[model samples]
Target chain A: MKVAITSTGNNLESKLDLRFGRCGYFIIYDTETKGMEFIPNPNKDATEGAGPASVQLVASKGAKKVVSGEFGFKVKSIFDSLQIQLIVLKDNEKKISDIIELLNHENLN
Target chain B: MFTIFVLNICSLFMSPRPSRLRKISNPPVISGFRPYGNKNIKGKVEAVFLHFEEYEALRLCDYEMLNHHQASVLMNVSRPTLTRIYARARQKIAEALVKGSQISIEGGKIYFDSEWFLCSSCGCYFNNPEKQVEIKECPLCKSTSFSVYAENNNNEEEEEEEEEEE
Candidate 1:
């Protein structure tokens, strides 16, 4: 399954599969297949409504799961509409790579 | 090609003569992807408080190279306020560069200017306001500047004579 990680800089993955239009980049990883693609977020100039833009960008990447730090209500609604799995950071301290490792472990079990 | 051309045409209509000024406001926002395989779990996120308005001011007056008076008018702030903003901005930016802190683009008592400027010299562009003071020097080059594709009309006679000679 292709999983998309929402990140800020090099750490902090999205806990839920949500992005504000303001985020800079996304990393797409294939859990079963071990493929990865880095995508720059497309909504650099969006003045408002970041939730829709984030969802559209992720959907374009054909990702099934999303991990991020926080998910706004508007973003949560869009992910619900799109049926994208959303996970937020539990302790708000886990690094993005650690989250990816956890996801890989989940897939194996 | 069509889109770029259309954007250029639109830009021409937007600001025929860009002023050499900057504003004081929130800092530039930065967002980007993580490098692959950065698994280190412990790093403190640091923030530098330059404010977006401060950045706007510097961009207009310093980078865009507008005089203080012109930049103040573009930002819709009084000249004195702009001067203060610019000074503070410079100090903070200098500090940030020296100290290495994350610059945050939040919380400022500033508003966006309605007008924007395009540089005639290097094609570097900025957004500012109309009714600004007349600017003489190019912000980037410090030379007397003109608008892109703008003809001085007075130079036309000289050009005609040169053409005739040729």
Candidate 2:
């Protein structure tokens, strides 16, 4: 399963971004293959409709699950309809590497 | 001139106001229900479409035993509207039971009320989006010491929002 995590920086050491829509980078981590890809958010500076646009960016990558500090209501409905799982991780100090390690657990359920 | 102005004002009142979106506290765990042992039945009836609002109305009015007015306030609709939805829900359920047709819950103008959980071990807040699967551990810390995060706090916040809107 591919899990997406919002990152404040392009590197794995960066803390998790608090805002899903305006995040700096979106890290697509494949749990099965143990691969990760970072995509800079195009809607990072958007004034409006950033959430939906970010959702499109994330969805297009075919990520089955998303990890973020928060998800907008509009984005939540879209994700719910797509049947993608949303994990709201509201820890400001959490790093991308730590999250990846957490995901690596055989029983992360 | 006065008569013309009166007629214009009457026309403005004729148009219906935009409806408020209904709030669903929780989605149904299962999508829909199917009838079994209906091979002896004469015909296959089309599935009954149960709106989320209707489901919520039935749940509040019948299951939770809340009166129409109380249910309406929870659902963000008028009392009469809640009664109407409850009526339709019962009608559809009765039809499904008698006719052996499937009942599908879907498609309504509604927004969700999020339920947040707090993990004591990790000191993190999380939510369970999938209604079927149970939350077993903290997503980050892998701890089972989590609790329902903000039951009273959320209620107070919602009440505050209601006051602000009013």
Candidate 3:
């Protein structure tokens, strides 16, 4: 499955409505092929509605799963519509590579 | 100094004829205020009320330290409108801290800012925590299988392209 991973500057990733207007970088991954790619978050300037834009960008690229520390309501809605999955990373985790390993583990379950 | 003086004079003249300065809006009022140094008292204020939009304005203007223009862009609002929101937020926060009043955040027209989805194929975006995501066709593209996009060395280049597009 195609997956997208995002890195955040902090913990406390809230619901998308509360934090939709923020943007960070994302890493796209494919579980079956173990392939990965990068896409610049176009919603970086957003402080409130970053969710919609971020989800749209990922959806446009055909992402099926999105791994990140937190997400907000708007992004959640878009992901719901596009059928994109959201993965919550542990608090204080910064490295995207570490999260990828976690994702690999989750895929097994 | 000169700008303030001109504004005062303009206000005096325009007060009688509102149409002359219809486009020039008044700066938002400070809803509350009190001295900060006297906060050692028993009834000291511990919080400040912030309207959602006003807090949004503060985040956009003060915390982010964005200029009115930049703030306007970020909030998807006009510079004048952002200025009004920022002014109100600063006033409320100042009042709460100075007057020893518990801040109760409220008011201001706000809306959800973004959209999202849960991938049906991977079950990544599903809301229910208990239910398992059943694999189907890829919801994003209707494909049975998919892969993530490759990272390109296009940060600077893409920024340049965006600027050009703008």
Candidate 4:
């Protein structure tokens, strides 16, 4: 399954982004192949409707799960309806690599 | 024919208004209750459906020992509305008990206050979208030390949560 994580930067060491819609980049990590793809959010500067637009972008990438610091009220229901699991991590200081490690823990054992 | 068209528009305004959405803090743990130790009828027994809002009203009033006014405030409904819901709940339960019918609890115009947890070891906050399953350990750090996050959406709910080791 592909897991999407919002990051503050393109690098693995960058901290997690708190805002989901306006995040800097979305790291689409495939658990099976251990591949990582960072896509810059096109709706980062969107004045309105960024949440739904980002959901469309992530859904098109075939991501089944999303890991983020926080999700807006609008995107939660959309993801819920799509049957996509949302894992909210409140620690904004966590690096993107650490989140990847946690996601791998389940697959490892 | 002209009068029939006007009557159709009049019927639209004559219907009663829909009920307001009740805010539920915590959903019931069990979906319903079943009666046992009864024998006679072999086939399936009749079921009494209990609404989620009615269940919340019962929990707030009977289980938590709150008055109708206080329970209504918790449920985001008026006192009289709470009373009506509570009355319905009691009536259903009574019917289920007397007739040996199953009590199935579901379906109501209600919104739940999302439940969130705070892991003490990792200092992370997470919400459980699936309310039925229990969270034993922290999803990120796998730690057991945690507490319920009392969201300050508007109410000031104070808690000094201390997790005990088993």
B28 Cα displacement, candidate 3 (Å): 56
Docking class of 3: incorrect
Per-candidate interface DockQ score: 0.01, 0.24, 0.07, 0.28
TM-score of chain A of each: 0.77, 0.96, 0.72, 0.97
lDDT of 2 by residue, A1-109 (tens): 7889999999989999989999999999998889999999999999999999999999999998888999999998999887677777768899999888887863545
Listed in order, each prediction's TM-score against the native is 0.35, 0.54, 0.35, 0.56
B1-166: candidate 1 lDDT, tens digit per residue: 9999999999978766542344333335452112233345347535567666677888788788999898888777778978898899888766665555556655565533322234454343222222234334433233444332223442796799899999
* Every candidate's lDDT: 0.59, 0.85, 0.55, 0.84
The collision pairs in model 4 are: none
- For candidate 3, the lDDT comes to 0.55
- Per-residue CA lDDT of model 2 for B1-166, tens digit only, reads 9999998998888876767778787678788999988987877689999988889999998899999999999998999888888999999999999888999998777765555678786666766666445567776567789866657786898999999999
Error of 3 at B49 (Å): 55
Of the candidates shown, which would achieve the greatest DockQ relative to the real structure? 4
Task: Score residue A49 of candidate 1 by CA lDDT.
Answer: 71
lDDT of 3 by residue, B1-166 (tens): 9999999999887756321111111112444334445646676455575766776677666766778888777666778877887898789877776566766654444432321233434433323221223234333334344322112423677888999999
Tens digits of lDDT, candidate 4, B63-155: 999999999999888999999999999998888988899999888888676667777877777666554355677766567887666687315
The second chain of candidate 1 has a TM-score of 0.43
Counted clashes in each candidate structure: 36, 0, 45, 0
Off-target runs (Cα >4 Å) in candidate 4 are A106-109, B1-59, B63-112, B131-137, B144-146, B153-166
